[model samples]
Target chain A: MRILVVDDMVTMRKIIKTQLTKLGYTDITEADDGTTAVEAIKIAVSSGQPYDLIISDWNMPNMSGLDLLKAIKSTAEIANTPFLMVTAEAEQKSIIEAIKSGVSNYIVKPFTPDTLQEKIKKIIPNPVK
Target chain B: MPIKVPKTLHPFINAVEKTFKILCFLDVTPGDPIIKNHKVSDKSISGIVGMVGSKYIGSFVISFTAECILNIVQKMLGEKYTEVNDAVSDTVAEITNIVFGNAKKELADMNITLEMAIPYTIRGNNHIITHKTDGPYVVIPFSSSLGTFTIEMGMEPKKKDRRG
Candidate 1:
């Protein structure tokens, strides 16, 4: 499945990309922050190359992952895009907010690759296998 | 439930170990903590995050030498960083966020609620990060294949009279 991994930290984006690649998916793109992620999503959606899923980190420097999710969900062109949020913060209020914002899944930092795969499967069943 | 004052930096240490193991694929074992000045060298990177809640108020900092930080960044990002630059320092900040975020989640599981602020990054040689709390900062030294780093925590019980 085509995926977009967004995080201000290149380390984090790399880690997610590596894990996704391990899961048998190679069509992955990246964005450093929410603003760029929005643009990438728009461009992809406009070109009929929309991503199957988005994995974004919360608490980035500029706009956050939540903001990107909201932006995508608000746009009719990409509103159906599935989103997964990754965050170091475990605040229940923020998790609730992401849920309310319509995130397809949520994973906290320090999570195992198996857990990540499970979340991916739930979001996009049998993703790349 | 009542708030319990922390007497050790174990939570922060565990947070560090857990974070690096998962994110960088390194198993970090922290050495015994030492109470020392919260100063860092000019060629070091520090990730700082403030902790505030009804139970506790303070900050968490992670310090890394230029060589040490570049090593981990390369491991995590797969890029060679010769010096501590603006781009590579984001690793320290995310490490700070993960350490503090994990600790706060652990505390919340036991009914202690704490709030975290945005993590700030500091770079330079021989610069000092002043702790909001008193002296004798709890500095827990840790080592990995890359190099050595320290996790400093300054914590204090919240004033009883304050309410938010």
Candidate 2:
């Protein structure tokens, strides 16, 4: 399965990518910001090889992960894709907002590799091994 | 020196302890809280993030010496570095983002609705951070097995807000 990781911070992107790699994921792509991620997702869908999973940071430079999730949920073509939201803070209000926006799962920052794997497993039970 | 830290600053103190422990696997011990003037600078590298609330606005800064930062990064990413570079600076920004984000949650529990923007990383010798607010800065020092670091915070409450 293909995955797209979107984060504004290079370090975070690298960290997540590394963790995902260790979890047996090889077909992974990265987008620096939410705007770019939207374009990338659209391109992937148009090319007939849409990403199976999207992991995005909640706070970004251009568009936030919530907005990106909303856009994907509103668009019929990519609405079904699984989305994992990464954030540093998990306030109740924001968590409810993300849930309402149709996020598959959410994880807080400074999480361990085991925690990441657990969260991913909950979303993608039969992910590419 | 043992100083009386404001209750508002406790969230930040908690953020630092939790972030460092989880991310870098370091046992961090909080030192005394030093209240200072409007502007303060420490160490060689710093990650600064600005925060704004309906009733208050301020900045949170985390500073580390070159040795301290490098040690922390090595433990965090499982990589060693001798000098501060773009990658190291990027790590600093991420740390500030996570720590501040963690603090915002507790602050919200106290009825303070604060929004966090991206963080800026500064590197050099004795780089100064001049906060925009007129409020006093609270510089809290922390120590770990790796090294030492400090977090400075300041907030300016609006005129109508009695509790800053």
In model 2, pairs of residues that clash are none
Cα lDDT tens digits, model 2, B60-156, are 9999989999998888887899999999999999999999999999999999989868889888886878565775788889888888898988887
**Best-matching candidate per TM-score:** 2
lDDT for B109 (candidate 2) = 95
TM-score of chain B of each: 0.87, 0.92
lDDT of 2 by residue, A37-106 (tens): 8889989999999999999999887799999999999989889999999999779999999999999999
Docking class of 1: medium
Output the chain A TM-score of model 1.
0.95
* Prediction 1 TM-score vs. true: 0.86
Model 1 chain A: which ten-residue window has the lowest total lDDT?
Answer: A120-129
- Candidate 1 local lDDT, B50-112, one digit each (tens): 778877777788899888889998887678989898777777887888888888877777766
User: How many clashes does the backbone of model 2 have?
Assistant: 0
